[model samples]
Target chain A: MQHMTIRKSLIWLGGLMILAFLLYTLLDVSGTDLTPQDRINTFSTRFLGIFIEAVPFLLLGSLVSGLIEVYVSKDDLLKLLPKNPILATAGGAVMGFAFPVCECGVVPVTRRLFTKGLPMSVGIAFLLAAPVMNPIVFVSTFIAFGWGEIIVLRFVMTIVVAVSVGLIFAYLARPHETLLPVSFAPVRGGNWGIQPLPPQKMTLIGGLYRAGRIASDEFFEMGRFLIIGSLLAAWMQTRISQQSLLDIGSGAFVSVLVMQGLAFLLSLCSTVDSFVALSFLNTFSTGSLVAFLTFGPMVDIKSAMMFAGVFKKKVVVYLIVLPFLMTLLIGIWVNIWMMR
Target chain B: MNITKIPAKDAIKIMILFGMSGYLAYTILSENLGNYINNSRFVWLTWVAVGLFFVLGVVNVLPFLRPKADATVLLIETSSIMPKSWIVMFICALPLLLGVLIPSQPLDVKSLTGTLSTTVSVSNTTVITRDPLKRNILDWLRAFSLEADKTAFDGTQAQFSGFIYRNPEFPDGVFMVGRFVVACCTADADPIGLPVYAPQADDLAEGQWVEVRGTFLAGEFRRAITPILQVEMIEPIEQPKNSYLYP
Candidate 1:
């Protein structure tokens, strides 16, 4: 498996170049008569914007995960989380307060914890809940919505959707069944797993050094997925006119879908999304906005792409599909019945 | 296996990470960072980027200095997390190339698709008390959303700068001072503009940065009586380093 040679590096570069070329053609065919210079400049500005804004959080997540890997003993982590699957998954729903990681940061952190034998339900719940369930986002939403239904509904709905989805995974999935083998760290519940490496004898200073090393390596490991995801999102934003997409679907059911679609497409940070949702107050129903607030933080283009790196492709699909369907039902219910 | 023959993935990792730091620092230093993100909102984050990338770069170097037998086990474990490819390794390094090669331009007419929202409010109550003269395009829209009578904004001293834009819907000799409003990043930026009835707008080219010192009055704009800026003084200005208004 460790057969990578210097000659193989060229292939990666070649793959990226092909991607860039394909992106250029997509724009060209999308009906813009663009000078190549204009296309590259506009797309690059957007691509870098998302990358730069999110990378800080990504690094912070990597750093924390590295710290957790070194500082928190595996036994401590296991003890902290409940062994009862339902209780653990339920606890995971509101566990965002401790981590406070955003959608961009949560994936890597969850993946790291999974390696430490974090339960499937906890990881799944935290993955979905962390973005919306955290304090920063809560405060932001509060400021936007005030002490009212929108704010309370957003949180409750997020927890409901996240926990429901988490329990679904916990009931159905084994750790190995959904996780990448390398991420299956000493997880006993799995059919097979990697035996823990002998603990390194270390001083406090040594631990810090080891943490730094793990974080940097992880930065490279997960960082690539972020870049590619940002690329696709930026490209899509440049070509698709968001206003046109939003102008459609004013009905109770359809507006929820449209708003959810907008959330996925825009991929705005969950903190600022309430303000964006505030703009739709006059046009969209309460439920759709709820869906947007809940679904957006749970699944968006960039975060969805990042999820692919840690979980199996099928698990990633469930990660999206479950949250989407549940949020949609809740949102539609709010529109059709609650608001009425 | 010859240890020296294999290009140390560790060394490549260091270079790529350090390169990320260098690129990020370059953006911050070059003042072109504003073209990509709202610098005012994310200034601290850019510093975090510089520091983290630099720290990570240093961390990668340490593995070589003290290569213990147990470190090989780490090597194998870490290797499994990423796809086995030199290309995949380069993907993290992709931004360095894109940032250096592409000249980051602030969004303007080229990016403004469809009609810009003149009356669309973003619900920022904080700026409702701020002086209208100090308000940007977004603040003005938010202010407008609070008032039922459109004429409440009339005769208010309006002073702000944005790129010039006009659509087919715009009245003749009228152009809008458009600002790209970003909640997070350029990906979510949407063009918002206020109409300005100025004969001089005919001479001003699209996407040209200009400062408008005028008074808002209810006038015919986009086929509606909205708070149209009756331009008193308009001057061509260089594009600001960070042109986006943070919502």
Candidate 2:
């Protein structure tokens, strides 16, 4: 009863907050002159642009997650994955070649996999590597940079970062510590028995029907986060100038830090970020450009929000901080090494 | 077995999803998707999303109509609506609603100025063609960035179309004509332009689309050695169907 009361009050508070925001925006729109109106238009356009660009990917992710939930059995998943944690982590890193999903799509899919008895380390590895290690991103990088050492370096560095993060999770964090507390335990009720449905006996038509249902459920669950994440990202993109960061950071270390910071804030997709990074090659150091590509797909403002939906708050913090530090170290090292 | 009625809350949620998907589809069908996403390539992705949304909506609504169907077919279990979920649903729907009610317009010049810095960087690898008349604002910006001596571009004929922009610092009879070049989407778009000098420059208001036939001459703007477009023929033109230039 107390819990219900708290929830009710929270809802009312949310309602009031939203009402205030709407009223404020309306007043601002009506009260402002042309300049403020233009600002509003630009903000909305960017917000919607990020939202529209991400919707398809989010839909694809939910569909794939739905299919996994309905069709793939725990016994089957266990049978397919290696028993050794290190080998499993390595397997997760390269798995993206077969399943190419952007950062937005990877989160739901990773969450689904984690809940399905997959090892936490393996899940972490897959989440980090899949966005960059995939074929589509590889092809795009090749197209952007052509045949070169930078492409090779990017591939190597991504695998190294993913594997390292995976190993760190495996060695340090307990399996239970990595996942969210809610819904991690399997439910042992309902007519479907211990299993949702008899794994082998489930009909194709029934599986697809179930898949549709699961997709819709997952879409709403994840879609809300996507919207909020994209809104924040779009807001930052509109208000901040990339050149300001560039101007301040001159040395190799500062430049890498600045670039990684930009990468997190910009929240660009892995497949196309190479082209955007390419434009910076003239102005930014090579190491900084590399950091932008490496750190972005693994962690960003959008992905961090999505991660909060799946992992505990502490785990999400580690996920963000660890990658930033690791990527920065690698970036600075590369910068110094290349200078010789 | 009787058809299971979809709870009112669930029904509302489904309709909202449908409305959002429909708006996106409408935008694509109308070729105004570019107004939101600068990339033309994403149109097909929007089409796919539309199909998926329709499927999900139908699947969700079916359980209410089919009396004999198993109740488990409904993906979301009908439960009392949580306030948190309601807030999230509202957040999800807010953008789609605003997108529909508000008329679609290009990003204004104010946003362009806010996002771009005072100095723009151009790549040295930018290929400069022999005929400069075909070069756009981006092409000239690139040339200016890479050129060792700005005076080399003097007497070069140039023609391009872009919207007008002027900073208070810009001298009278001089204004910038620029376009936003999008690498992936509008979020990553960068404003690139060249300073144009004409007797009537001050007469043209900002954000007015214009076609300028001019000669590129090395000149100073904002105390920096930048190439200035010496306008020969200037005419007001309608904004391009797609205001953004895709790289």
Candidate 3:
């Protein structure tokens, strides 16, 4: 009961912060002497700026996802998972290195894995960890921050949050209890080695052709979120005074929540989000910035909706709440310990 | 019939993707993409997007080329190409539309977020002493803060270019020459400035790009003791190909 109350209040608090930000943004844009024409022009350029920087990565992500969809067989992957539930779950988190789908691609990929009889906790861990665990993101973050403390902080926090959340579901929830019928039907087989689906076979060129076809569709699917999310970030920058936003970000606790909030709201691809986070380096606390890097990739506007599609509604709540609280606590602790 | 058989929604999506690709290509070829983003990484990335977009559109059309395929194949293809809402199609078309309609302009003298950043501790520090004449406003600004004594800048010849913005309270010969330093994109640009003491400054207009070559003296700017660039030669010039300086 106590846990439920605290969770409820946090949710309410998050909602209020978003609302307050929106209200403040509206007021600031109105007060500026910018004619509607200037406003629209400025917003349009900013939106295009962010969109241009990210679209290439989104294209690459979709292509990689599409190729994986056609070439990588889930039956083979099922055999690779560990026998013990705990080991399997941890392996799932690290397996993101092999199958590096971003927040958007991870969803359909996770869903397909679920249907191939992946262990529930493993599937859950892969879903959260795969976005940031891949090589593309590693290279991008390295380019943005170099081999520095930020990269270490980002990856460390992601693994910790992802593994802990997966273990919670492993200990507390049954596969059938949390997954919807569409996903649960496969899990009903109930073992690491269950192989109900038929094995696939395809020629090299045939797989390439199919991969191209799938990549195109995935591009369209993921591209929608990218376009809309860029629009929101651009619009927010136009409306809110960047200095005032930085001023609010000066506090350790508030900055973490604020960065986390922006992370959720922006819904950028993990491959490119480090560049976005790099801009806030001077003002935001270290922990909050890590929270932005970790939590944004794990659970955000697009990924949350995708999670809803794959899991039961009750489980979706748990998926978001667990990562949110864990990362927030870790972020705050980092700020206090690392800053001084 | 084969073209009409293509789902209307799919057709529009293909066109939208291709149109965006063309718009991106146009920006790159015409040198306008730099107005919106730093092109050091994106020049190649944008070309990749061009190829990917073209490939995506071509692949979508490839199925229509085989009009007389097996019935089961047709059924399977149609299933994945389910008709999407017109609203989503509109949203996807937005970037291309905006790119064409809006005149692409960099953030100019008017958009300074706060007073010009006086003391910035940049994480990526470059040695500012390479060539005093070649130093941009940002490099010089860093040098100003790091110097122990304010008068150390005296007798040092400097030359730099930036758009102009001024304070009304400034003396007749003084104005702020400012540059917007961009790391990733326009969204995070922070404006930095240097005070130029030029008797010819009143003739120059705001947002006008100029090159000032002169020696610096310790002087008051923004009510603080900072290096003031006294102009020996102030020449009006066209905006550089890359307007914003990358750190």
Candidate 4:
């Protein structure tokens, strides 16, 4: 029986290898207009370099995700927030500001927090708010937007989207049932599974180390995603023509949608997307630009995957849907206000 | 009904190899194609990194899917991850890709008139010029309160280029409004305004791109202001194509 299983696994792996080889060949031909095996080594090396650079970071995120699975208890987290929906959501946004990590860094941490027993509302808020509303992100935005009437508006809009999403999800669904934590972390049931009743038994140092381990693991595991996301961003910058986007700069709403679309597709890093958006400054209105900033980091391809890994499929759907609408509304408001 | 999984370690070994293979494939593809596409040396390495990620992804899933295998073989495969030939290949290709992508910062031209072909020739000249000191003055204003130095001019040579911005406070004259220069993005964007000292203010209209080759005449009124230019020529150039310098 085991032999048969081995054979099938081998076959599965072999198929993957064949697929990789064929895809490589197809891409080689289609991309460079090159014949078979002409510059395959060169192409492979370039691709490998990107992966190598990203591995360290990916390992970090994964380890962090793993630790959170091991150490944090979810029950303790639920006690922090009120059952009331509005207060809970607002509390989530406030907690998001406490962490200074970017969206990439936030992924594992968030999953760990959710696993540890944080309420669904708070977890959702951390996911959305940490990327944009955290102190580090806020300072970056302040510097980027320039201190104008729009500065306050950007902050308010980000908080609104993050809090509203968290609150809506909290009332709509509970964390345990909604985010599919069951598959990832199967905690033992009963009192033994729970840390001893007296929480103060552990020293501060011990708790700090545990927290550090969890954070680092999260960093390593998700590092690859960041690397991949950044590379895709660079590719978009090089391959995708900006002129096409430039053509639709006439209408405010159309322009906002297009720019937001570009943000989603481009998936540029938060550190760099500001500059890219600024490049479009003369091309699009401020409102559209705001939409691009708010939407990109919140729901890029990678963050979406993280959501899938941690939350329930239903919650993931809402997580994606709500912020998108909120961003559009904010964009329109900014446009109308700017005109006035 | 009974498919075996590879041992966790062996699966990891395969993933590492797959990652390497993906890297090899990407490099070959890019070297031939990247140059023709608008390639940057800074980002050329990015493709290779991407390819490596495929290998990492392969490794990442190995433990989950690998059929349970023996410990000895897994150890051998793990050691094989680093061999002499692989290292040599990586070193040889990196510099070649970098050579093609770096040292060129291409400007994106938005105006029909502004777009210049990569083939456009620029002759190096010894002429010393700056965007304008008025821009510097405006930057100072942004940092500190705006103190209109009606008497701030010293008749010193100041270079400037920008659209004309009329200040309602000083309707008698106009200020040369230019966006501040930042290497990366608007996060660092600063604004600067230069004092216009031309005789016929109406001749140089707003939004007309021009190179001002005159000296600053520090004075409050246009009547007292003087602009000395050994070369006072106004030629219409293309509007600034890139709205922000580094977005």
Candidate 5:
């Protein structure tokens, strides 16, 4: 039954990938009247630039994830967290303020932290806050804008949302019963006989070997999703008409939805997303653009999938919903504050 | 049964990742290492990372190369499977269709061209097109002029086009105020000053866009010594297609 399930899933996934490709192609080809050569030039040049920008971050993120899987032990993690969920969530947000991790790097580390016995709420909070609350982000924005008020307002609003959403979910969640089934069985070495044994603790000199093993496994499972997601994002960005998006984002209700949806779909890092959001300054409300920056990296399609892989469906649902709501509130707050 | 088989895939993937990581680290190191090494040229490390990622992406497809079982397993029967070729074709074609063959309004090209042609004013001379040599000399002079906070026009000329927003003191002259070009939004926008004095300045109001041909003169206005332009001619031009640089 398990074997059948795996096969079915594989076939379904393959089919879905094809479907995504066709949809992307149709969207892309339908919009442009460019000749074939022009299309090719556009693809090669644009994709090359994107690859140059994106590949380094992806490689670094994956390597860090590999290191965590191989070197970080689960038992060491549980000792650091508070038993109480509220404190744990708050602690996680505070931790984000110190660690300068972007969203891409946060997912694997968050998953590792979860296995290490950190409460799911705490892990989720760290995931949400780490991308935005970190000092690098704040300092960069301050340098870019040269205004303390904008930086301070963005920081305070983000933290309030992060902590509140995390606490709300923590209160609602039933961790032991609700946690999703993660099919992670650590690899074992020295295979000899018919009996299947549990993963063994290898020597520290075997660090490279262990890291290699973890890296390869993760590279296969996660790498496929990364490439496909990136390609999809690249395609959508190229094909979609920004006129409609700009029009929609100009309004309060539509702006929140479009901003949240685009945040998930684009999968851009926090550092660069701000620049992209800047183009929208004249088109959308300052509040909506704030929502775009604040809400995007915290919860997106890629992050949602990562969360679904580690956390229960209910938890993932809450994580998505909570960010949307909080971003709306933040948007509203910025609007009122600026108006005042 | 196939311990070596598993290790083979693992080893190939490892080598690729390692090569990439090593290359990136080396590149970053080399950027700082140039003082010690005393070499201006070396193979860039980013290329190595690029190569490894490309190789790893290909290696990832190797696992699916195994022959499929003809018979049913786990009480599930399948008569036909989609060809792997079709899947691969679709996957490869995906990026091109979505990324390249799409219509986006050309905004950058228009604004950059407009910015270049716009003129500035200098004393008694219509600097329709600036000599590159003179502009270079003016840049050096601009620093000293800015530090001293004096508004004076040097003989070098520039073509500047902007709205003539006049201050109470410069009602006869023109305070050429323009919106700043920020990477993404107006939050980062800074207003730049390009002062000019033209006969048309009296007709131009706070937001009326005008083109001024002039040369920089050293002088003081308000508190700062600015590089002021002597206007040769002034006129209005329509706003360019893209109000914002990038969307």
Candidate 6:
């Protein structure tokens, strides 16, 4: 059949491409000087660094998602969510305190929740807030900035931004428009949306087996975006100078925009970004630093790519743009009121 | 020979996942984890991830080898493995391949060129300790970032170690001795150093790690009023086991 021929050709082509890449890598590695000065070396190292750092969190998220798929009933999840949309959004914003996941891990968990019939508004809030509003990031930020207004303000602004975004989704978008395709949805009364195993098949060994399969599936599905995202981030870090970007912007407004732009490009994990931001404390204004902290975990290159996997294209665009505008405005206002 | 039929795609996924997890565990066990991640705390997480991947991989692949297992159930379970999933799996495997194939090295002097800037103003509030010789390059850089007047550091003895960085704009006898201060990972590393004035500075090759024992003298270097190290001694040294300074 033509289909079989094409498939065979594609497999052969993929194998050959991988072989070529391996040979190239080996040649590069075997060279006498293998310092990170070379663009190829630097890019590869940083790319692997980001990927390696994120994998553990991603795996944890998948396991949790697997548990959700097996044990947490759809009706029970819905029952836990508040009836009022506003209350539900607030609940979502604060929910991350109890469930602390990094930006890399939050996407798959959000997708799992969404497929289990979680309200879009609440899911959106959790997705954005869970990265920064968690306890780990909170303590990290506190340690980095010390007992300062910046730390307190970061928390306040994060909750505000998350809740507002959630409210917007709740009031503006329809349920179907916000979610992924129906086939990708998690079916009720089944482990991972496959055919429900009989009561006899629902033993402990059977459940563990099902959870492992679901976790593996979810890891591969979400991991592609993480790889591509990290690749872009690494490329930008090597090619673009942070100083050049910082040099152009000086005033409160421009500085906020510049720092926010840097945050998006860097796509650093929330737990560690504060220390990096601290190095800039002397160079950048207070408000710009706040913007960097608030906007980064909410939307970054990596998170944006992950968003594309779960939400509609239009929804993804809003998720990126709205956060930029919100963070920029808040940063400028804070600059005028506090920095002065 | 009642072997259960497993989708070929699921088998491939298991192999890729298992391979990546194994590679991660190897990196940690080999103590090459610092080449990628700056934090030692992440080693335990990597171990846990390896266990998860191995468990999941074995579970997914076991059905195909078992005799008299229901083929119908296996087929239904493996139906989720789509043809497009191969692309995702390939991407996931890429970093692992790169880690193994490519030689690991720390960022070099070239990375410093783009990030270093001359106009960074120091605050006056930095508390300079009485014994200035005890500070590292980062400590000196921090003191430099805070010092309002460069002249205050004059005659202060200092000893520090870092790679040599030469700005083309500097005079023949001047070069910056710089080290990258990494807050989390290499991506966030920022180069910070002090300019040293040595009569034999031209003899030093860039990117070579060296220790400079010198006294801080107030002077203008490269058109900026900054504290310059009057180098009394300079010697080449092996790159430290942990090349990057953690904040």
Q: Per-residue CA lDDT of candidate 5, range A88-186, in tens?
A: 788888676654667755765565555455665686688788888777677666654456444666666667778887777677765554454442222
Write out the backbone clash pairs for model 1: A12-B87
lDDT of 1 at A140: 89
lDDT of 2 by residue, A118-185 (tens): 78788899999998999989999988887776788788888889988999999999766777643255
For candidate 5 chain B, the 10 contiguous residues with the lowest summed lDDT are: B71-80
Q: In model 6, which regions exceed 4 Å deviation? A: A1-37, A182-193, A198-201, B1-8, B68-84, B113-134
Off by over 4 Å in 3: A1-33, A100-120, A139-148, A169-202, A249-251, A258-285, A299-322, B1-4, B69-78, B81-83, B110-115, B145-151, B167-175, B197-199, B203-205, B218-225
| Model 6 agreement with the true structure over A1-340: per-residue lDDT tens digits | 9999999999989978975764454335343334433767777767777787778888888878777776677798999988999999999998888778889888888888887788888999999889898999999998788878789888889889999999999999976787667324454233344455554657787777776767777777778888878877877776677778888876889999999989998888888888888877877888899999999999988889888888888999999998889989999999899765
- What is the C-alpha local distance difference test score of each model? 0.79, 0.77, 0.75, 0.50, 0.51, 0.78
- What tens-digit string does per-residue lDDT give for candidate 3 at A1-340? 9999999999989968985785455345465444556666677777888778767766766676556556556677778888888889989898879877677667756765776667778888888999999998999999878898889989988888888888888889887788767555544553121112232555676566566666666555556666666776776666655555556656778888888887776666687778768767766788988999999889976577657656899999999888999999999999999878
Q: Where is model 2 more than 4 Å wrong at Cα?
A: A1-35, A187-195, B1-4, B68-84, B113-131
| True-structure lDDT of candidate 4 | 0.50
Q: After superposition, how far is residue A266 of candidate 4 from its true place, in Å?
A: 2.3
Question: Alpha-carbon error at B114 in model 2, in Å?
Answer: 3.2
True contacts kept of 5: 0.03
Interface RMSD of 4: 12.9
- What does fnat come to for each candidate? 0.59, 0.50, 0.42, 0.00, 0.03, 0.46
| Candidate 4 segments whose C-alpha is farther than 4 A from its true place | A1-76, A182-238, A312-314, B1-247
Model 1 lDDT at residue B40: 80
Which residue segments of model 5 deviate by more than 4 Å?
A1-32, A36-52, A97-99, A175-180, A183-204, A249-258, A281-283, A311-315, B1-247
lDDT of 1: 0.79
Looking at model 1 chain A, which ten-residue stretch has the lowest summed lDDT? A188-197
TM-score of chain B of 6: 0.81
Cα lDDT, model 5, residue A323: 84
The per-prediction tally of clashing pairs is 1, 2, 0, 80, 34, 2
- DockQ, candidate 5, comes to 0.06
TM-score of every candidate relative to the true structure: 0.89, 0.90, 0.81, 0.53, 0.58, 0.88
Q: How well is each residue in B1-247 modelled by candidate 1, as lDDT tens digits? A: 2232224665677787888888888888888888877788677788898999999887666444444555555444333234436876778778888887767677776765566876564443444667767888888888777777999877889899998886657778788888888767787787888888898668788888999998888977656668888899999999987788877
Which model scores highest in TM-score?
2
Off by over 4 Å in 1: A1-22, A25-34, A185-197, B1-8, B65-84, B122-127
C-alpha DockQ for predicted model 4: 0.04
